[model samples]
Target: MAKYLVEASYLSKGINGLMKEGGTRRREAVDELFASLGGRVEAFYFVLGDRDVIVIGELPDNTSAAALALKVNASGVTTCKTTVLLTPQEIDNAVMKSGTYRPPGFDEPYEVENWEGEGGHLAED
Candidate 1:
């Protein structure tokens, strides 16, 4: 299973519905949704400011995560963004792989790793 971070903000219609049903109902609805997907909701909170809800959960894969986002967005009452979470060990594994790449307009010349060159002659505009 993979972890995901969900940030959702309720629109006016959703807010009105929330006010009528209260927050506990909203949490229950989320729990039910995850349960139906064979997943689990780890943490859920109704917060202030730009986002109304923050959810942490795990699903089988990225497809499941995307499905969750699409379903929430189709509701028309709320907007959601789903982020794929990575652990520290995953990042370490990623850093071990070698790849070729260039930055910006450095098609002329550039070096990403260790280099021996004149101090002021390194970068160009």
Candidate 2:
């Protein structure tokens, strides 16, 4: 299974619905949605930011992730961004590989930061 980070921002209609149903009910609804898709919701958080909610879960693959995103987006309630999440071992494997290719005009100072993998946070690119 692949993990995904789904950042969801509620549209006005969705927010109105959420306001009536409240957080717990909203979370349960999401859980049901994932379950229907044969996925499990690992974590769900309602936060004040550019995104209204952040969800982390494991799905079968990228297709499952994209399908979930498109279905939710089509609902006219929320827009979502889905990103694949990699574990530390996965990153270490990537870092071990040799690469020399850089994007066009990609000269810039790189900043190094450590990720603790707390909540749904993944390593930054």
Segments in model 1 whose C-alpha atoms lie over 4 Å from true places: 107-112, 115-125
lDDT by candidate, in order shown? 0.86, 0.86
> Least lDDT summed over 10 consecutive residues: which range in candidate 1?
112-121
Local distance difference test, candidate 2? 0.86
Measured against the true structure, the TM-scores of the candidates, in listed sequence, are 0.83, 0.76
lDDT (tens digit, per residue) of candidate 2 on 83-106: 999999999999787655433454
Record all residue pairs in model 2 with backbone atoms less than 3 Å apart, i.e. clashing. none
Cα error, candidate 2, residue 15 (Å): 0.7
Clash count, candidate 2: 0
Candidate 1 lDDT over 1-125, as tens digits, reads 89999999999999999999999999999988877777889999988888999999988888888889999999999999999899999999996877765656567545544344556344554
Residue 76, model 2: Cα distance from true site in angstroms = 0.8
